[model samples]
Target chain A: MPHRITSARKLMQGNEACVHGALYAGCRFFGGYPITPSTEIAEGMARLLPKCGGHFIQMEDEIASMASIIGASLTGTKSMTATSGPGFSLMQENIGYAYITEVPVVVVNVQRGGPSTGLPTKIAQADTMQARYGTHGDYQAITVAPASVRECFEQTVKAFNFAERFRTPVTMLTDEVLGHMREMITIPESGELEVVDREKPDVPHEWYHHFEITPTLVSPMASMGDGYRYHVTGLVHDQDGFPTANPNEIKAKMDKLRNKIVRFADEVTQLDVEMVDDAGIVVFAYGTTARAARQAVHMAREKRIRAGLIRPITIWPFPDDQLRELLAHVRRVLVVELNQGQLIHEIERVAPKTCKVAGLTRYDGEVLNPVEIFKRILEVK
Target chain B: MMADPIQSSNVTYDYLRVKKRFPNVWCAGCGIGTVMGSIIRAIDKMGYSKDEVALVSGIGCSSRLPVYCDFNTLHTTHGRAIAFATGVKLAKPSLKVIVVTGDGDGLAIGGNHFIHACRRNIDITTVLINNQIYGMTGGQCSPTTPHDSFAATAPYGNMEKGFDPTTLAKAAGASYVARGTVYHVQQLDKLIYGGLNKKGFAMVEAFSNCHTYYGRLNKEGDAVAMLKLMKEHAMPVKAAKVLPPEKLEGKFLTGVLWDVEMPEYCELYQNLIDSFQEKDKE
Candidate 1:
């Protein structure tokens, strides 16, 4: 029945577009439990996946959901899971396992207000750091933040692409506002966008290894039932995918793991930069707060306050080089986010030393409208 | 027979990666070796071309079984082996998915996933090694720790009654449920073989003893003494039914306690897809 909804101009919710984007990205398996603000993704996947010849499983808990998706990904299936704050916290341990094992998965975290379930339905971006560091162990993360409903579609597709490209879990970090926000979205037809699948081992079975290192560093994966008969462990391993205790081998593996994301920074980073070429005060925002920052920048320009907006599309692999390049001519940078001061610290560390960086954060479970951000823009100047 | 690649190699080397993985990270007299041997033998007997097999285990001593196995192995986080195996099974229904978990890992922290896997009745075999204590973390009282047993954590003797995992699995709707002891090696091998061949969720709760921890703490002597005690107290469920109710106290019931066929999870899911595609045809 859902396949009959072929209208292109329909007002799709952010979470709905995310599911559509996942399907467009060739995701065949979704293993997720319901959580507030993120439940719609699961519901959408549950309803629409089978219609598309895909799989949807409502797992027992967040940990299982995380584990399940990783398992599915190991079968050379493009897999994903969705969760909000509390469930995301429960999934942190296994999330680390996915990291160390270098599995390709896209985890959708619809942010809600929380230290611990602080506001189930309210919008907040307080989990920015949690998404980066929630999982224990030494591995880098790839987090993508989507502000507009269109980005919810495109960024999710990119999230899948990056997950497959890096052979690591990529997070589409959307908040309650973006998740629940309804707006018209244009989803490209099949083959309109590039879809990536994880590379498969082309060598003979005797010579094949699961994490075989080449110039790409992102090793080609082998499915479980394939004749490779490979091993995958959460423990550090050599190229053969077996656990190793040797310090040199462990260090080499860990170095390659970290360097894979770091070296691909140029190709992976995404940012929305507008009018920052000559602005005195540039506003940096992400997610819900970026919505207001765009409006505030437009309003500030009307008054000739020389303001612009730089919204980070890729939040985890922080846009250090992009921010430095964009904020070169700008004098003051105002970061507006739903959280009090999460992303501002990141901008402070990366933004050029010449710029005066400030944060106009709202953590009171309220949206930072254009007026609030406009006030911050004026105050920063 | 010698010309065959599988038969040409020894049992352990045929099913495992290389000899470098052994001597396993196990102590002398560890019953886990016996259980691991049985698991490998069962896989060898099935002769499914191990590439079609995926052995997944969560973090624990028992979970380490996958690390030594040559098959496509996934050593995941603690207590979520069944959940991971569920993904493996659903993704590729043709693959024989097996989860190796310990009592604490399966019933304590991962209890939610364990029961849900049973309820879903997914096609996977879960071999839960119940050592009655946390062996890897040095003998803490596990969920299956017997009442009044001395564990490292329960130095004064445990007050809680331990869980019968077979009952838990059966109650949770696992299609096949069985219990076997490390002492009864042949019976355990058969139970595991039956479990692997079962169409839906199958659980074999093997009562393995941790001589280093639970055994020494409870004065059960060494591994041999513990095995001897288990052999004496082990009663077949059929045999226990004939015994007086009072005499059955403290005796472990062994054998196939539960077996029933139901609609398998992934197979039914495929039916759902076919029906949806049928609607699409209209």
Candidate 2:
């Protein structure tokens, strides 16, 4: 039997907390394949979803998992799927389909190692760039990385909200260390956190255009069987959601997709800052590495070395504007991650040239420790 | 027997989204349009409201059926129509979900989803339009391309044997399996109507003609010649049973090949949910 959390406070694994978060955020459908380091989320949903009048289907493969969730979401149900590296790689094609079609779905990638079945049980943040640019086409991604079990619950709810509000897929980037590790987390009761649902079309069925370019650029969506008999295609389509080859309509369609997320970048990016006001050096990190960087910053402050941390909860839309302003005065910015200089290049692109941006990297399927981050901070400073 | 909607003089165009696009992308005299007409007539004969049906298709010439139809339509990725329709059906079992896919889209790249969907016995209706070639991508060889047939990828001749879709679906656990052809319009309508009315996973393989690609490459004249080929070589399942094996050598059998009752995936899942809720009440 699946353990149902009745109390507000409980000690839970990060993956378990994600299931709670999804349920709390009104995710009623889950379609996923069993992948290592992320199977717990699927198992939990399989046990619990049906009792709540939801549906859980174990699809044939990761691609089908992604496709199924998109189909479920189209029927006005909030849906999600979870997978690790190999599964996540298989999902790229359908992920691109979701983006182009503007379907609201949540994908949880519990980070594992490598290019080809690298380290299924170990942790690596190598997929950080893949989360941003894994899909072939040009589109913005709303991705969130959680550092703790508590944040796993919180960030998952946030991921769904972002997905619904933006009408796109949001990637929940968690790694094996946080996915399997246990921590005390206070689960929010009902109505404690804000839950946003997608906007619905209010027009008559005949006037309803599935991809209307509104002032907000986020068109209202209509579910299947709602009498708004609209056509949805993965092809480049006009506002009516039918395939079109006209160059002008095609440009407008692409612009509508791009502008909806880019125009609202501020609302999509979330950061956690610590002691950056009067510090000469700042640590830029995310996911589990940010947890180590947090402890490392405190250790540096105890030694009076003037160190701080900027941990991004929302890792995409790249947090460009915020990082540029934060790194303006700091002389040294150290990018910490479990991969060989993936996110560091992103940091270098935004950080002023005078601000010497460097990377403290590791890629041998091991976690980065606070002491190692601290030593790197000392060397970079 | 359902009243023949095809023979009725006042054929309702209510199920067609005629305003969406004028003159669809299919070639003139393509058998896909005839197959689409049969689907419309079948749904109309069933008296289903346009709002209650969802037409989903993947990328292909035959997959374009949904865009011109006045239903809750979804034209999805290259070969993921069955996977997508599974979600739609599982999430809202009240809505009738139908998937339309071609030979390449349904049997080649989407073969795993196809067989597994049957294995699960989900309540979905799949209309597999088999033209034996990838018509949209310029006559490439497909999984259903007959052995020794010529294609763009098989310039000399195709070396692989074609799949028998009805046999495949029956083996994969579909509760209903049938085969029809565009040449037999009324029979195709009845086959699709029967597949749609079945409760579990149902597959109706409709033989269509891709005169532009498959016909031109093989010197099969035009759409008329290709369809005439189907009329000449196709026999009903009953006729093949009594005929000698040597006598029916090159002939393909049509009509219902398999039909049985099985528990559906969604209803079984709903029962699971009900059991848990009942225990909680206790």
Candidate 3:
């Protein structure tokens, strides 16, 4: 007997792929506002979520959308939201709430030119820094960037898994270029990918604490009405989940929240590397800029110039270890990003002390082509 | 007997969190405690178990009530309690979701969410404490603050007219709308009970006070004097219906102002899902 293979190839846009990926990850609720470039993700969710027995809501604004997803996630439902710059700005406060409460939610920021609604329909990687430090406070953030339509789907599911595993909000950062581009992506069969759910409390109901800090720095989460009647507050609280002004308790809670991401940075960080062996110049890029970097590497190879590309899938954890090892073999490093030297700062900080680091940036709305990166590669020589 | 609140408690204190002190963060003479008492009584009378109830609140003095309650409480960001409750109710329609909010939190910064929640007619109860001023923020003028009233921000006097929450909620399409005060404990309890019984969005605006702030600034004396003033001023909606239009002028009406049955947002969504599944079968 021959096994049948279903046609997995479908022409899909990046934002649309993100919607399907969220569905595959068992997302049951989505609350978000419609913004340029990211609107397709919301529209796709509205059409598919209800059809798939999920709930899709277009909130009045981004703040409510962010709060609503957190609310839904608290009930042990996988939830997400999608938005661009302006809407993402409105969600900052609640994003902080989701962080402090340790709620598992995925927020997709399809990047557009910003600073004050700079360009609604244009692609730019200006929000790389914002994704890390947008909300006011000290906390670790998990942000993944996708460069292709296939990854728009793959990375969105990964974002949900990370959110549930760490019991924190995860961000998927893409740009208008990838969000709008239509390409063929293989849809994996059901059960082909791994799905992670938050750990439920195995303790007795009376002894359950919502913020119980375990040795792993990740605590088990129980939804409302799970026979574990507990309190979830944004205030600094003790292990019992009651607000306290004690400095020792506050430090322990804050330290655990921050260290959870640090201790597991290797587990959370992801990078795609190519042609690094015996390379003279290594290019580090992310999001749409990495697409151009891939092409530039191919062009450099044809000209007999040794060029390598290291694309970061997980941007928040910075992929410092991977770059430190790659920088050792290279004479110089060229950091390419859509913004003006944002991730370059991280590269320069951790790059081998013997190697010089330079940045090739494009803050304007136009997407960087392969020629721009190729030109930078030649200049670095 | 009154001095020993724990001994003389009429309702079950099982739902109340034991960790928080008996004396909450409310001001010395604030009326929020009375309102909170009324809400607890209503929940007690409704016969809801502690496990089946979920209380959510936004930032403000009134939002602090959730911390003192043990029923799956979620103290959220400022002005987002109702929105959060909407998500909870939608996710678990079996849970009785309630929001405790203040005038400044619910009507000012959170006005958009408040109106949308009412418009959607989601099955959740919101007890809005209209204190006429932002007591938590030390007396800024709020949406429900009376015109020409003195607040810390409105030193010269407020220039805007206050809103009647019952009318605002009704216009926003709440299935049940009511207005009561801390002065009318029995009536407020009954109104909240009516809201809980409804299957759609229900709002009970309990006109509360900032005796430490509003009373000091307006010369309304203490908490007792403020309650007395509200008692004398508040007219029941049923009573106002009988009086002539001119005679009812300058009177604030209380009691349940509106009640109607409508398809709830979550239930409608569930039915919609069923309908979609039904189509797939055909």
Candidate 4:
């Protein structure tokens, strides 16, 4: 396919691409701390954000970084922060605050090996589960995984759009390999990509409820100085955004926090499926591991074996419906990930009952190769 | 419009979120309410429109003060109010930002943020309500909890020395730092008002009474007695300067402890942006 490029094409690191993507998406404020594998994103943001008339602050820590972005977003600026695993762990508390208060912000986690500072500069997808359940709460998460440098740019833009549209924190999961690896990519020019801003309340300031529940479930947000003086709290709040403990109001608030994202799951789910229509065996993978999975699928097809690849761009609302429909006829599915086993559990949940789901795991801080995954595919028979 | 808080009760009512329930979450005679009134009176006296101000707070009894006030209020996670207010101020710079935090919330769990916020010298007014205990979570030892004072966590009595918040702020590069007691309500208002008018990071440490927790746990009597203790122990900074070391040993200093000029973070950031973008245009 001949692609139209309105801007200059250049060789860029994945992290550099992410910074450009964030700028293209109208992100005006960045608050982050320095961490390995992901530091480039913060570095690039610091170097470039000022030229764009935006602000970049290196916070005291990841917790403050998360808190700062939420605060910036309240003032109607598109804000984001970048960090790795240990820092992501520190950000969980404030991420939960963003979830409960329904503030729109983006968190970019360039995955490094971790249980606790496991491998600072190595590749690992162990945070896939952490991205969903890291915060102590019962709210659904919106996370996107990008496998390539080009996808890194595109996925980050999509991440911001989802955050603004859903009025929730969005996580972009890119690993060490993708974050540091340089690749040739065509940067999208201004006005080329669709940028979505948060919906502001149209009602009079007196009638404005910060968390007003409408048919869409998402509320129109007002910036701090916009004159709609409303209260936002992490406490279970009513539609007017005041803390409330009334049982009915509590349930309704929880339901709104959930269904706001859950009901729009299909719209949030992004998937790339190749040759899965008639394949008897398929590999499920995401992030950098999906590159090997794709290559392995091609190798199996060349050998006259029916094989396919399914990579989810959106990892958290985890493409359940798409996988169910795609895997109905598949007899066996192999999950390839850089972790011990993460997405396999979700695949096992959604795969057809007749299909055997298995995980080809690697956690020694090494990327999976096409041969190793192909060998696993042959063993699936 | 700058009416005295004691003389005018009707003026401060304009700042309350009157639609919300009355009889706030604080215990009776708790000094947090008095500190809240002081803040409200300070903002009222300054004549800032409620729409142009943002009140950010972390988790605690004092943090709940923002929810009751008519302004853009954000009650964030524990120990993160200053960090959030930093973003709010840096994002807008036009909005008057204030952070209401407690001893445990501001100086302990959030100590790093508190010090860093002071170091940045951003344009933010922080009202640190130091009751010397975690009042909301019951009587637990805080960063400002007195040495050998009883608390739920420090039942055998706290061994660590308490932090002098005004001194800490001064050392951390704050442009303005002041100490006041809830017992000195008018002075507290003046101190907070001084913080509001300052251009850079401002810290107003208001020594409040956690009578429900710190008072009862230490057998320091009820809220009234705690207020009396504050009144008795407080000394003006000017008076303490002339007094002997022994005469000021157990007494705390009231009024502005430090004041200086410093470049505000937001303005510095904007200048950097303008310089860079102007060069880019060239």
Question: Which lDDT tens digits does candidate 2 get at residues B137-248?
Answer: 8999999988998999999999899998889999999999999999999999999999988999999999989888889888987999998999999999999999989989
Per-residue alpha-carbon lDDT of candidate 4 for residues B140-245, written as tens digits (9 for 90 to 100):
8899988999999998989999998888999989999999999999999999999999999999999988878888998889988998999899999999999889
Encode model 1's per-residue lDDT on A1-381: one tens digit a residue. Answer: 233348776698999999989988989899999889899999999988888887899998888999999999999889999999999999898888887888999999999998897999999999999989988877688999998899899988999999999899998899998999999877787777888888888989988867776787888888887788877888889988888989999988988899889988888888888988878999888887888889999999999888888888888888777778888777898888888798888888887888889888788888889998898788878
Better of 2 and 3 by lDDT: 2
Candidate with better DockQ, 2 vs 3: 2
What is candidate 3's lDDT per residue for B1-282, written digit by digit as tens?
A: 256677456564665665464668877778887887888888999999888899999998999987787688899999999888888888778899999998889988899999999999999999999988888788889898889889999999999988877788899999999999998889999999999999999999999768888888888878899988898889998888889989877778999889999989998899988898888789
- What pairs collide in candidate 3? none
Cα DockQ of the candidate 3 complex: 0.79
Chain A only: give the TM-score of model 1. Answer: 0.97
TM-score of model number 2, chain B? 0.95
lDDT of 1: 0.88
Worst 10 residues of 3 chain B by lDDT: B1-10
RMSD of 1: 2.2
CA lDDT of B133 in candidate 3? 88
TM-score of each candidate's B chain against the true B chain: 0.94, 0.95, 0.94, 0.95
Compose the digit string of candidate 4's lDDT tens values, residues A1-381.
112234579799999999988888889899999999999999988988887788999999999999999999999999999999999999999999999999999999999998997999899999999999999969699999999899999999999999999999999999999999999998876677898999998989889999989999999999999989988999999998898989999999999999999898988888898999989999999988999999999999999999999999999988888888899999999999999898889998998898999889999999999999999999985
